[model samples]
Target: MKSIYFTIALLFFVFLFGCGDETPTKETKDEVVEPVLDYYPDNVGSKWIYLNAEGQILTRTIKEGEEFSGITYKMWQAEPPDAETEIWQAESSDSEAEQVFFRKTIAGIRLYTKEIDKSIMKLIKEDFKPLQGWALFNFTVQSSFTEGLLVELPLKPGLDWLVIHIRAAGTLLGGKNIALTLRFTGHSSRKEIITVPAGTFECIRVTYKYEGKLEIAGEIPSSYTETMYVHWLAPDVGIVQIKDAYGTFQLIEYDLTL
Candidate 1:
């Protein structure tokens, strides 16, 4: 009767509320995001020229059979840094003929010619080795030294900045003890905003530290010093220019195909 009816009604309400409680609650899921990396091409072809502190173009192209003859490349009016001026001209030949030219014009004129088997870029990247106590690029030379030259540049996108660590052993000429330790740090822009003579370029920074002495027989004395330079370039923009503590060097002409 009435009592039974009341009990039934209470059971129905309990069942309804219990069913509602069984419903699942809304949950928020975290989305997985991937990191962005810098893009580096397989081969980077560009010509770099050295200038004097006087703002003069001291580097020139000399024919192989020119007056110097056996000289595959040559430069006149070249000079090295001195107490008054600190600058020199060093050129690289991307030929297997093994030829190189170095000149320094200061108190006196000095010129050197050597048969180089590889290009400056190849030599630098091949001979690069990490220091004993340093935190730099964890890179190891692959089977072919050339392969190691082009590294898989890792970058975190949205930073608008990329940093690179370069370490290598430099050769000393004079009897003076050369530490052969150098730390080079460079950066590039993540966004393509800046423009250069070549094209649109990204921002970049380069810093270096030199220890020990470098001496040349009968020319320069051994001394310890540090140097720094900055480069601005991108795939779209070949090479805008470079700014260093000493001076600024601009890209007169650039051709990536070369």
Candidate 2:
């Protein structure tokens, strides 16, 4: 009977305290991380110097943030005021200082707006001088233009998007109709290794093409296309080289420390 009582007491003691002295285990969670795309670096004070097509050195710097229609954008200023002014100055008059604004998101980088002393409307009018058709469009100034998507995120070969579309129509003096359409398109072509004055880099090759269609009664009209600019963008370094009708612009030096 004593042995049985001892066995029962031992069983009760273990049942009461065994689980109480055990340590609790923690529940762990798995974290999901998001990927970041750094196609263009816009840190304030970051500067990039390039040798423009005209054999002239051009410098662009990321300055203070500027606001447009309640939204803020990074201001990019190109020094020496006008590099391609000669191409249109005789027709549009003396050019003025210009600043381009940009905004970035997960989707892509956008041309939020731009600033210029001369009116964009005036420049467009001068392009079609002989016809003298009234210019009607969305943007009076460059800033007035709708947000233009400059680069699409997760870029891959053959990726393309319509950056901007402009249409204008008016009646000419001789009871003839004049119509014009202009489109700016962006394409992510391929990866390339570029060597410039700055150095060599592996970059994403992006091209901007301008397509235009002009129609005037009794005049032959067909759409024409030309490359406005080609950019070799280095990862996190921004544009390393640019090729345009004037010539090629290559990166000479860059300072991204800021």
Candidate 3:
């Protein structure tokens, strides 16, 4: 009877321990943690294409790195030829890129100082940085294009921040100069599931509004405003689409040939 009782006790112990709550293994715990997303990958040969509502397509490509005044910058160029290009000088594409140089300045809203040739010099203002980014303005046109944070990493809803701002004086031509100023306010208000030609993605919708004015030496000050909406930044990917008064844009193709 003692031996039988011993066997029953052993079985009871097994049932208590073996059939009880289970403990999670290290691998299972690790599996529950998601990897952080690196939205932008700023590398050579990275390219993006967008289709506008009017069926117009735009292509942007990252080219070889160029050095300027002891600084190296990745050239982001628009294909099929355009008015301006940006000098994005940053170590990682996963974060916001800095603009050390701007090819054109928006002296007037849509009135840029491009066709005027080297008569103008576009430069980052007073070490003025919006969201830690360079603010560009033209010395000749005395105007600005885009400003503030180009891209905000680890995008999430209710994420709001500055993009760019510029206030500078244009060069004197015929004994007259113009004072130009621009302020860009932007934010990522929310997220949505979006579909494009390339594929479907979970994107963070962002918006920017610009309030700017231009004052010529001998004329009354003129004011202008502009707005932009972008909905193409996908998790693990970068900007996939964009929209502005110019047209509505959607991502058609993308490649990170790096």
Candidate 4:
């Protein structure tokens, strides 16, 4: 009887120690680290096709050959606006070297160039003032590129509004359809929170918009008009998507490191 009792006690001790080792401890909610904006990329690249409300392709290659580096972008769009097919291309190397080119069925349409400066951005921020609305905020900037002077604006308003405004200039065609491209830099905000399909994730979003006219001097004496919106979804390291009035393009597959 004594031996049996001693054996039972030893088994119980072993069982208790083994169970303690196998059971996992509950993690405190506070100890869990929520994902930060650092997971988003700084740049985004994509190809897009613009469709009308009926879901018909209205414009071809709206974002083809479009690449966003940091705060700047280059893109082209072609559409059959009238009986003639119109092609437009815009490029911006920095705050400078922004140019716009256009071609229509009409012969001898000239290309225009313009300059973008700080005063333009300030003027835009002050004008077309945006009112906080919905999950987004909207604002416009009066900017000039080689093509002509125009306005750039963001339609969505939300947290980190200014950061989106500054990053946005880089995404504009730099006055691509018009003439010059507006380059925006120098941001003060760092933290961002956004609602994504996966869930609400913290991130830094950059946005900008511009519109203006294009003139080809001594060419087809007509002014071409354009308006654009750009958004860089930066969760942390790089951009997750590049969004415009047409739609959003996912960039995670092209570069996962972001």
The number of the candidate with the highest lDDT is: 2
Reference-based lDDT, each prediction? 0.29, 0.61, 0.49, 0.28
For TM-score, the strongest prediction is 2
Candidate 4: tens digits of C-alpha lDDT, residues 130-181: 4121121232234333332111121112422111111122112122211222
Quote the lDDT for 77 in model 4: 31
Model 3, position 96, has a per-residue lDDT of 39
Q: Report model 1's TM-score to 2 decimal places.
A: 0.32
Q: Model 2 off-target regions past 4 Å?
A: 1-37, 52-55, 81-96, 113-120, 131-145, 218-220
Better of 3 and 4 by TM-score: 3
Stretch of 10 with least lDDT, candidate 3: 7-16
- At residue 14, give the lDDT of candidate 2: 5
Off by over 4 Å in 3: 1-34, 81-148, 170-178, 214-224, 229-231
Per-candidate TM equals 0.32, 0.71, 0.55, 0.25
lDDT of 4: 0.28
Worst 10 residues of 1 by lDDT: 7-16
